[model samples]
Target: MAGAPIYSKADLARAETYKARDYPANVDPAIETLVREMMSGFADKWTVTILDTLWDSGTLRFSELARQVTGISQKMLTQTLRRMQRDGLVVRTLYPSVPPKVEYTLSPLGMTLGAAFCNVWIWALENHKAVDDARARFDEAE
Candidate 1:
């Protein structure tokens, strides 16, 4: 946490190659491609982490989510979940309690992307040693 950036040779190469691609403004990535990319990164960012946690746990109380993910403020998580709901990536259900109850889960469409996330999870579990080794090498380098 104290020092240099961590990236593998392949990571750096992909970064450069993606930067090198030149497509006209009219040439957009396919929707499926974009969706797959997002799904694959389901554990990499706060918003994605929120989604992936929900994916694994099924419907979860709103407070339960806030307690699990570190460093996410209540307002921020609420906003992210709202956006996912709007985008059809998540479903929100509210119950009329004496106070109120709210739960969140994946939509059927979201379930379709679960396999993509599962693959990323499996790869991360399998190759985290490589990631740790890269971090060590990076920290030791000039």
Candidate 2:
């Protein structure tokens, strides 16, 4: 850790200015913990897409599922499947075959969450026009 560039002049001055701004000294402990916990449960687009795909089909081969989802690479698809399996959102099974066979299906928890996602998506579709108008207005503002 020797010569690790400890606090260059610019960095030290930025820290001082941030401190001088006198931002809120404290946040509600409960709100802080709640926000952290809530945010930690968030999933990105690819993960949600995989989950949604599995929800649409009870079980599917890896390649077939990838076909159903647009613009997903084999590497990314495999990685996402493994992560979902590790998280207990998906169950991956391998079958012996001349070319090797595999299948993926949602676990109980995955199904539950998938159902929730479906509801949220349905609501979005139902309000698509409103949302589209909002987006249009937002872009115009920008």
Candidate 3:
């Protein structure tokens, strides 16, 4: 406890003020629609896994990406990559060679999204045990 950090009352008040700001309720309809569409891309389990894999590995060829993503079917990977490319989250490059190599990398927008999602990953890591415990308790109750 001695080494634990403490927040002053002023710090707590400032944090509360920041948290109380209601930006989402007043968002423009078009902007809300666009945000929902963008967020839906991440609603799929495969999309988040692919993004996380690419974020860590950077510029992987199609086969390498498929392998890294683990359990992802070739068809699903191709479809997800194409959708990501269309959404500007990933850039797909094709080499005009005899073998015709293709590679996928996160676009600038994808990098930004990955950065934002890092906080979510951290939160999950921090709370994973608590979540598992809660689920176990709920199951026991049932």
Q: Which lDDT tens digits does candidate 3 get at residues 23-92?
A: 6767899998988998888899889999999999999999999989999999999999999999999999
lDDT of 1 by residue, 1-142 (tens): 6465666798789779978889566645696687576655454487678767877788888899888777899988888888778768788999999679998898987776666768878979977887898778776774
Q: Count the backbone clashes (under 3 Å) in each candidate.
A: 0, 0, 0
The reply for model 1, stretches above 4 Å from the true place, is: 1-44
Ranking by TM-score: 3, 2, 1
lDDT (Cα, 0-100) at 9 in candidate 3: 85
* Least well predicted 10-residue stretch by lDDT in candidate 2: 1-10
What would you estimate as the lDDT of candidate 2? 0.79
Instruction: List pairs with backbone clashes in candidate 3.
Output: none
Better structure of 2 and 3 per TM-score: 3
Q: lDDT of model 1 at residue 24?
A: 65
Q: Specify the highest-TM-score model's number.
A: 3
Please give, for residues 1-142, the per-residue lDDT of candidate 2 as tens digits.
5323334587578679878996567988998996585335445567888888888788999889989989989998888788778777899999999799999999998898788788888878866776676677667666
